[model samples]
Target: QLDAVPSFRMAVHPHIGTRSLDLVSERDKVGFETVLTSAKLMIQEKLSVGSISAHLADKYNLFNNSVKKQREDLLGQISSVESGKAATSQSSKCSHVVGHQAACCIKFGSNIQFRASTPEERESVPPPISKERGLVVREETCDALLALLTGLKGDTCKTLCLETARNEMKNAGDDNSLICDLTLLSFVRHCVEMGAVALH
Candidate 1:
């Protein structure tokens, strides 16, 4: 199971914070290029005929039974690797509070915001990621993007994807909102063009 994600990557300690992943390397020139490329990969790697067929075959299984299985397999694959890293660290501090509702979120200063969720909402509070107004790719997108971006694999990439998505949504504005909508449509068009998906 995925742990509740605390928003923000800023660290009182080094290499930790609510949204610290937004910060980048000395070798990289652009602020978001490293991240955006990863984001693109997140969407692309899943752009296979199977995934596309899966999306179309079952009338959009983006948040179906398969996702739960995917989550389980992904989490299992990465936990061992992450636990190992945490063990090596002098602090050994890589566990979330047991019952906290975890989410991928965007953090601004001390504030953290949840990203989007596949399942629709019943609660009053907004999910870190928006539903109608925004374009949420998928867990596949998250998995792929994080793998490409942080050079982290297994569950670590999952966390990285959630964190990055949170940051991406957090940065959204009116203009950005329009861009997201266009991006979603563009994604559909691109999927058809790339022969990764077929149009209805």
Candidate 2:
């Protein structure tokens, strides 16, 4: 791509009168002028080429760095968006679990209220304390039920169980055959109290 170096040429100065000058001396003088002109042109051409090359290199480097920075900025934005999505997904899942737990707690409390209306209705159910073993079965049962609700994993099963319990209580009417024992009522009361405090 480079321009070829100009060939050296010999010529006599127009100002020098060839009529008065010696032919041999004129030829020598022309040869010297040719060499000087060739050397100056060559030096100028080399400097021009070097300057052009340096300018192109600087431009290319600036463009390359700009592209690299843009790519990094794009990747960083993608990472931030993905991280935000992950956090939102986790928050939604927690909210769903808390919602389920709150529903179960409310349902359990409602069932307790429906069962334990009067003093006689409460007293009719036998005490959970086993006289011989000293084991409180009602407390254990309430604890197990609370654990199930807290887990929030068995929605359909819990709903079915609650429905069955409510039906049984309804059928018992004024009889003492209802399963809303005193220990479960106490557990429900405790949960309501705790929930109230948390809200405050």
Candidate 3:
């Protein structure tokens, strides 16, 4: 965005006005003022603040658009990280197990553990889920966000959540077999990245 407009930058931090441009005169004494624009009648005489303001607006608008596009793209990416077409080798269900999905995707708070039909089923994934404290959705959301930061997506952990959810149904002994390992967190991460957020 700053590629044009002479040597101007679209975003001049407030600190720049206070620190770098501090102890300065009203005019372009150190070129800091030129970082954006000088006075109304300083540049080329023909240059108008209206033109500069319009140019800056366009650049900022473009930046915002780019950010928005990226967010949508990320949402789509995370949405399909676990492709519906990419099914497991065995289209199986947790026998005599039950599954329940989270209220929503972000995992903002509340660490919930899905119970099992029998104490044995809980150990299938090792270290059976014992009744414990719940984490707020925000904590889980932060963890999910941090997941994208690392080389590995927090998907495995997300997988565990889904597994636990489905496994809880097994604990109930419903045998519906509607278990899926997709975490809405993955999708939410995509949403945040692409900037198509809920604004909530």
* Winning model by lDDT: 2
lDDT tens digits, residues 1-200, model 1?
01122322222333334345556343443433555565566668656789878767676444345455644554564344434234234122322111112211111121221212211122322333434333344543444333222332222313222334434444532123222322333333332222222211
What is the Cα-based lDDT of residue 17 in candidate 1?
Answer: 44
Compute each candidate's TM-score over C-alphas: 0.20, 0.18, 0.20
lDDT of 2 by residue, 1-200 (tens): 12353444324465456555555466766776677777787667676867889988888678657666644554454344435345345334332121123223322212212121223323333333445222233432544544433432233223322344435444545233323433333344333332310100
Instruction: Give the poorly placed runs of model 1, Cα more than 4 Å off.
Output: 1-58, 61-63, 83-162, 173-200
How many Å off is the CA of 49 in candidate 1?
30
Please state the error at residue 54 of candidate 1 in Å: 19
Clashing pairs in 2: none
Model 1 residue-pair collision total: 19
In candidate 3, stretches whose alpha carbon ends up further than 4 angstroms from where it belongs are 1-44, 74-200
Q: Model 2 reaches what TM-score against the true structure?
A: 0.18
